[model samples]
Target: MTTKFGFTLMSIQEFETWIDARQLARTVLTIQEHHTYSPAYTQFNGSNHFALQQGMKNYHVNANGWSDIGQHFTTFPDGTIMTGRSLEKSPACVVGQNANAICIENLGNFDSGKDAMTPAHRDTIIRITAKLCKRFRLPVNTNSIVYHHWFDLSTGERNNGTKNNKTCPGTSFFGGNKVADCVANFLPLVTQAGAPAAPVISASAVLKYVSVTASSLNIRTKPNASSPKATDRDAAALGAILRVYKETNGWYKISGSQEHWVLGKYTTDVKRATVKADTLNARSGPGTTFQKLGSYTKGQELFIVKEQNGWCKVNMDDRWVSKDYLVFA
Candidate 1:
């Protein structure tokens, strides 16, 4: 393992261990696969890993005007994985479908007749993807692990590459980039890729759930701030719901088996719920008299931070909805 230019480079084995120890605040549902069309195999020389990664970050920040590198992780031709953007933030790789998603940019053009996939690189890609799916409790399905070519570039809709889609992940990525191709060629490898178990505690075991009120909350190994970070990138983003398993001093244990703890001061009580009504209005205050911000369709997920009378605050801010329309999860 090595660190350079604000990125941590690790082998496939190290990544599996590192991922299991992380205590992410946001719930992840999908894993996006992409190909770095610009920095092809020609640019790689078995070295210069940091230089290439830093170049992408500079382009994303300056030219693209994004806060940081778009992808959360990048896979090198040498089978090394380098960290990019924060795991807490939604990736900028996919346009309209970044929420609750993790993006992996394989470092190659990967188009037909361009950069034939190396054996080592292929192994890394497969293993890392399987590890992420296991870590996030996501199933190895088309909806969970997807190719960049599946989404429309203009509308960010999942049109399955019918139109307005770039051959991203490419025409020759793992044989092909189409949904059918993924089902036939790519997904099987990920599903069969051997991965260790990720223990998830049942809801009954959870003492309570809390919503992060602060913009970013640091996760510590012990109950005190003096303890080391629980993981390399250890802060949970705002609006992330944490399941508290144990309480010690002023800290809350956010993980089931890991020693990950966070300050109770930065969090507020919350409940997991799903919208039961056909359409539920989100208001500024607890009453219908308050201004309506937006509406949530049926089956939409939300965390209730505060409840007053028959209304529930859906978020940390003033967003409120009728508790009558919610089914507690």
Candidate 2:
């Protein structure tokens, strides 16, 4: 690995090995494809990986006011991989979709009639994407592997290359940046590169709701401490409600479009219920004799951790309320 500006540049094989050994603490669901629009192909000298990386970092940090370079990795025309932002943090790529994502910024602009993609770069991109899919157990599809062109540039909503979107990965990236283009020209190669089939969650698996008890909990790509992290701050936070799909070895797999697992030890499994009363007191204990912690609005979602004597524990903490004011979900 070549280190510069505290970032490591690696060959595809090295990257594969490095990522294989990492243990992340967040959940990641999507892989975003983007092109460095400004730098273009001519800026690269084929060996200035460090210089280019530092330049991008300066821009992202100073101009954009981001904590670091926006993407997790950068792919060069020669197929070298340069690490950027922390994999543990969410990328500042697509606005609303940055949660649970890993972003890749290709070195050259790829718009139609722009820089021609080199054979090495094309092969590397495909291989790296496939490797990530296999490592994270993500299915090769439009949802799991996404293009920046699919979102609105302003509002950051998924519009499928419709109104107000930038041609990001680019207008000519892999035949086109639309969802149909991915299905036709991109996903097949990713599948051929050996993306594993998605695991099927059985109906027999009991579904449970839970709230994060830790100040910041790690959402993993798999149900173990050795797995890479998946979700960043956008998707997970203290008191955030998460749906548990399955359980294994004290880890709970969260219900979502992707495979995200969190340690059950850091979360409190609860029943989802809404408030029935216009205003109900949240107490320090299960009975009315307990101190009033606060009051909740009607229709507010409450996590019922434990039920007792017509009262429900609203959180992992000792907050409770009468069961009569709650409508169990």
All-Cα superposition RMSD per candidate: 5.4, 11.0
The list of candidate 2 runs beyond 4 A from truth reads 200-329
Clashing pairs in 2: 26-229, 26-230, 26-231, 27-230, 27-231, 28-230, 28-231
Regions of candidate 1 where Cα sits further than 4 Å from its true position: 195-213, 220-233, 246-252, 258-329
TM-score winner: 1
User: What's the distance in Å from true for residue 168, model 2?
Assistant: 0.8
lDDT of candidate 2? 0.78
**Candidate 2 per-residue C-alpha lDDT over 230-300 given as tens digits, one digit per residue, 9 for 90 to 100:** 74423355555566778899998875445778899988776877678876777778898997655555554
Q: By how many angstroms RMSD does model 1 differ from the true structure?
A: 5.4
Report, for every candidate in turn, its global Cα lDDT versus the true structure: 0.82, 0.78
Q: lDDT winner among the candidates?
A: 1
Give the TM-score of each candidate: 0.74, 0.66
- Residue 12 C-alpha lDDT in model 1: 95
| TM-score of candidate 1 on Cα atoms, chains taken together | 0.74
